[model samples]
Target: MEITMYDKLLQLPLFQGLCQEDFTSILEKVRFEFNKYPAGSCIAQQGKACKQLIFILQGTVYAKSIDNEHGYVLYETFDSPQVIEPYSLFGMFPQYTASYHAQTDISTVSFNKSYVLSELNKYEIFQLNYLNVISNRAQNVYRKLWDTHIGNTAEKITNFLQLRCTKPAGEKTLQIKMEDLATLIDDTRINVSKVLNKFQEEGLIQLKRKEIHIPALEKLIEQYT
Candidate 1:
């Protein structure tokens, strides 16, 4: 394996604390499947079984969750050195909640469930790191439940984005109609537009047709949260 590939693997949450020797040993035992994807390619489909742990080594991918009943599609961007739904690999559903598409030409490395259980789980650091990742996700979702009541249109809009986002900080693009967003936040279209316009003016976001581009999602969260 290339040194750069090892470096990227080390950056992942599950492999964070492994020593060079330990990491090398594990790698030797497992056959990691490396793959490349072109921009606009569908990497994974929603509702498909998540049989492997896929780590994005390079470039960007967007996850789209469709709500057929509610008639809305939520899109969240995940950049390099991020894992795709690690918690979903062995859960009750064991399926992807969102469809993932390559936003740029991307490279990914993946290991099947069998290797994860037989090899990765044996390492104490890997086990702890995996638990931490899952625990943090659970805690985040739990905390959001208590943050249900938000003040003002601006805060509501920010809260909505924060809840749906995969990460707290990133360049985010929300693909939803103005009226639909207003409905979701329980605010009037005029009020939502006013707040969004203010955000755009402040350079916090760029409002395009049926889209709101957040240059840095953390800044919006800080301003509103």
Candidate 2:
């Protein structure tokens, strides 16, 4: 691997805190596959078995999750240097929760589950990094359960998005009827529309027929919360 690429890989959460020697040792022992995807190409599908650990090395990836029971689809875009659901590699359901597609021409580095257990897991730093990532995710979700109450309509809507999204900073799209969204947030349709229109006017979001497009979720959250 090129020194530049190695440096980029070191920035990833799973590889952080590792010395150059350990990093090089793991690389020499494990076979890491590098792949490129064009824009609009499907990287992974929801419910597919996650047999490998895929780390986005370049470009952007869009993730979409459909809640058939809830009658909505959530879309989120992730930039490079992000892992695609590392926790999904283990557990009873070992499957991706959302479908992912390349938003732009992208490159990725991946290794199978067998390599993860037999090679990566043997490193103490790797184990600690992996554990911290999973633990932090769990704690964030748990904390959201207690943060359900928001008096302001905008804050409530922002909270709803933050709770559903896997990452707080990203481009997000919520495909649902205004009425359905209002119902979910326990607000009147008129009131929800009013606040959304205000948001659109302030350049926070774009309101379309049955869709709400947030250019930047972090900015939206900051504005409202």
Candidate 3:
């Protein structure tokens, strides 16, 4: 693929702060490689080498794996132009716990590992994006450890609920399902159920089956904090 595909990345805050002319040398090294996987096909496997940085240009992908019981848990999803790789990439290590699978017919623009690093050293903008990759991961780690195990079920429910309110153009309704939220929070569905129900009964939230709506944003955040 051509460098034109990366034009979308230019609009990002990290990339917007950059001038294309300044990074022309990097784009010369950047290339898009096409690959197709049918829906439900594993794109990258666990414990394998992650030799490329994939930015899906079309369709959807899933970061998924099974626990001891062998139930397929969808950990995360990636749409077009979104980068998908484990934390090991920044540390320049082998694969991590998760694997990526196509949730639909998909294609991506991959970066040569050496090219990416070369660009990072040559361009400050790419360097910021590189740091961003690690910063986001660190935030995720903190969210997981945030009083979750120490707090009551209601507190845990509130913690996850905060994200819905903060989402870009998010409605009171959380567009995702309880089962998915359970995996993201690393909690059992039963525990998630108990927590949600308790919060709902206390009038902290309004649960309309699959939709978890927050009616009192300020009060809810206060309680969770």
The C-alpha TM-scores of every prediction are: 0.92, 0.95, 0.64
Candidate structures ordered by TM-score, highest first? 2, 1, 3
RMSD of each: 1.7, 1.4, 6.4
Of 1 and 3, the candidate ahead on TM-score is 1
Off by over 4 Å in 3: 1-4, 11-16, 69-72, 157-193, 196-225
Q: Top model by lDDT, which number?
A: 2
User: 1-225, model 3: which lDDT tens digit per residue?
Assistant: 345554755644335566656656556666647677789888777667777776666787766543334233324555666666635565656574567788899876566577666664577766777678678766755775675554655566556554322221112445456786687666788888887887788786777756666555556657666
Misplaced by over 4 Å in model 1 are none
> What is the Å distance of residue 69 in model 3 from its true position?
9.5
Give candidate 2's whole-model lDDT. 0.90
For candidate 1, lDDT tens digit of each residue in 1-225? 568888998999889989989988988998899999999999889999999999899999999888776456767787898899998998789999899999999999999999989998899999999999999988997776566547899988988877777788878777788998888888899999999999999999999888888989999999888
Model 1 deviation from the true structure expressed as Cα RMSD, one decimal place: 1.7
Q: What is the lDDT of candidate 3?
A: 0.62
Give each model's whole-structure lDDT: 0.88, 0.90, 0.62
Clashes of each: 0, 0, 0
Candidate 2 residue pairs in clash (backbone atoms < 3 Å): none
Candidate 1 residue pairs that clash: none
